[model samples]
Target chain A: MNAISSFTASLPGACAQGLIWGIMALGVFLTFRVLNTSDLTVDGSIATGGAACIMLIRSGVPAWTAALAAACCGMLAGLVTGLLHTRCRIPAILSGILTQLALYSVNLRIMGSKANQPVSVDKYSLMLSQRYVRAAGLSNPIPLLVMIISALIGLAYYFFGTEIGCAVRATGNNRVMARAQGIDTDRATILGLIVANGLVAFSGALLSQYQGFADVNMGRGAIVIGLAAVIIGEVVFGKLLALNFALRMSSVVFGAIVYYIVLQLVLALGLNTNDLKLISAVIVAAFLTLPNMKGGDRDA
Target chain B: MLEMIDVCKTFNPGTVNEKVALDRLSLRLEEGDFVTVIGGNGAGKSTCLNAVAGSFAVDSGKILLGGVDITHMPAHVRAKYLGRVFQDPMMGTAPDMWIEENLALAARRGKKRGLKWSISERERAEYRELLAPLGLGLENRLQTKVGLLSGGQRQALTLVMATLKKPQLLLLDEHTAALDPKTAAVVLELSDRVVQEHSLTTMMVTHNMRDALAHGNRLIMMDEGRVKLDVRGEEKKKLTVRDLLEVFEI
Candidate 1:
């Protein structure tokens, strides 16, 4: 197969990963974009989800169910940040850091005496009963993409349309307006964190299942990756927060696809593995400055 | 039907920046009473509305709506009885959602929200009916994102959304103060139509002395956190912008 066809064939995988990581993008989106609060909780919540899913899946729960439970675990992790921020009057960013630090140990305990689990090597053997893979045919990426994308779009569209969604959006855009409209800003912040982290952990659950294990180190650079995808998504649409639901979701999904394609290109070109971090950093810097890269003057 | 008894508020309490926003500030509103308030910066106009809406717990006060003591209720709990439009158009609704979605959220005020579908055909029809009243051609734009609307359109929509649930009190905190003169006039007309149609008790704060006298049934002027002028009935109808300025010596 030519490089082009090969590249086209792998596009769906990247979209699916983008779609999954969009959950992380969403958590990042809420704290950063929507609530206008800087929350670093996602760095730890991603690992929390992976650890919970790995531990649960090891004890004989279905992978799908394990993923859902992991999402809940991630939500509780966010709840900690919310409580700290609201009850203690701490700044939102600092509260996030406190929770992120505490969850480091909490996540360690969820992994069953291990710091992390590797799924590519550890999960292939135990993913599902033999009958399931045979039934699913293990040959098509379309089904997985179909399921994940549907969940992301449908749930996202619905959640942001509700009364609570309005409250959350209002809180982020202007706390004073929310208060005038009778919305409890504290409650809105807490709700945003719960939903954001829940989606992040959902991505983690899928990440472990698809790649075949969870690792403690997996979440170390997650905030940067998630922010990159979100920023890339925003760049595609010009980062207008008030864009309609479709554009809002597209920012994150498109971002993830572009991020993956870049990595795939690097892998295909035989780039040194040790240079991955440097490559990621450069790409992030470039994307960060992409709007500025346009010939338009910054002041203009 | 709203009452504030000796409402008192202090900001940055117990610190060097301690400032009294409201001090022994008492106010009352009978059913369908519309009052306009004007004050200089830091004159406590916004703080009064905040205290009544439960945005902050007043240090010492009792707030009652239709004779129910709601002084201690959280903001959301009191929201059912209060409809509000803010100075900024973007402050009122979720801009990312569709116009109808914003309307749906407002239309169901005081009801429990569930995981069920939010915008059904019936809900859309209801939203269309609500938008039809505005006559800004917004009923046709239910699918549009509210963020794409003009400032006047947003404030008009906000007025419609505020009254959709028929709250006991409608509060406008310089809602049109942020708009241009022409757009502000359109929004003010919409506000007048909706408030009169619902017979809603209302309080509006505006810097423009003319707007303070034009639409509402009564008018109030605040100076240094106190009511400097209050007029209603024939006295209010006979008053002009000059009368208001002379009364407050502005």
Candidate 2:
């Protein structure tokens, strides 16, 4: 009974964290599913966003402006990765890895050579914070996060229906067809990576504000977590929400929440927190193999 | 309407697998001319067509399309004036997109793509009219994904896409090679109708000698990266598969 109450108390906070990470998952979906490239830059860019945001806030920038600026920084990171992949002729995954490795030093520099920085809500007037997570009315983070996600989804749906967005989609689907149709495929690819990393950094900015601190290692293994959210969302809500683009994106958010809920449950069951990364790896691997196992059954 | 002046291209120069794909090959197409290209394996038939389509740069040559020098233009920039259909049906269309969506993409081939909605109601009606004549029932299946269609249907859709906006030149590189004979004949007939309807300057490459003789007004046979025979008008009308075989020394 005691453990159950403790788990219930933690549920709201878990949900809030899930929503923040959902934005990052949406970014992952853009590269992994839509653009058909597995970009590892998010692992570094997320931290860059956090570092940039917290430092800006510390230096007296407005919270919203700092977040936007952080997102732009992430776009720059993505541009580097795009140039490496398209212009330098490096492979996509390798390009991401190189950018991610380089961003470690860049991230540290952004944080004024510190590995960690904290922005107390009391001092900085943050947009959202964990302190008011379970509070009622306007103070609750859930409603605000929902509103932000809805706006993002609406923008994405509208943009994708437009001519430029369709060109980007075609670039991902078939390069030969895209070129034949007169699309600058390399330009389209660069634009996609730029937008994807921007979203990832924006999410990181929000997460830093919520947790009241930014750590250099906060974004470690971020790609796996983002992939977990996307795959879990598809596996659980894919058929039910396969109606439109908005619903599909919402499913990714819900998937992130479910992942956090599961994580909280296991933690409450007395599992050592040190093994959290191991558990995450196991969960992702199991989910990744599920579809292949079904296909193997047919072959057998 | 199109000119290739002494274009030369070599694949993997100085390597063991080096090949001279085009060796000072030159060809010109008059407006409204429909030419069929025939050649054997390694005869540079497709390579010549690709060179015109800007698939690769010629090592040393000039390509002029409609009086503009486009020898250095990239493939996508060159695509503003040229339409292409490939040997593989899968190469010409986006499989995962809707049929109407695919047509909408082709409709904006040479135009600037902006923030405007991709498929307007007017364009939808236009695409429907275009698909109706194919007799493939694709007009009713506008929302269906192209991947679900058969190979023959895709090739037909690709043909319509290539001609959606009248191109300065059309390049068909053995587009029907992978289809069954009956489907190939249907697509070929459709191709003839569309080309005639638009009076398009078209170059069709095929391995089948009979198809080469039957479709277009002019025929050219390529051997070792150069045109060996250029027959047209009265001479092309009297030529047969026997005459072509004699030229091949088979």
> Which ten contiguous residues of candidate 1 chain A have the minimum total lDDT?
A126-135
Runs in model 1 deviating more than 4 A are A1-38, A118-125, A128-146, A158-185, A209-212, A234-251, A267-271, A292-300, B14-17, B240-243
Which model scores highest in DockQ?
2
Model 2 bad stretches (over 4 Å):
A1-3, A296-300
- Against the native complex, each candidate's DockQ, computed on alpha carbons, is 0.30, 0.86
- Tens digits of lDDT, candidate 2, A1-300: 877887999999999999999999999988987789999999999999999999999999999999999999999999999999999989999999999999999999999899999999999889899999989988788898989988998998898889999998889998999999999999999999999999999999999999998889888999998999998898888867444767888888888888888888888888999999998898888878876776656654
Candidate 1, residue A259: Cα displacement in angstroms equals 1.5
Model 1 CAPRI quality: acceptable
Clashing pairs in 2: none
Each candidate's chain A: what TM-score? 0.85, 0.97
Query: Taking the tens digit of each residue's C-alpha lDDT, what string does model 2 give over B153-249?
Result: 9999999999998999999999999999999999999999999999999999998999999989999999999999999978899999999989987
TM-score of chain B of each: 0.95, 0.98
Q: State the DockQ, from 0 to 1, for candidate 1.
A: 0.30
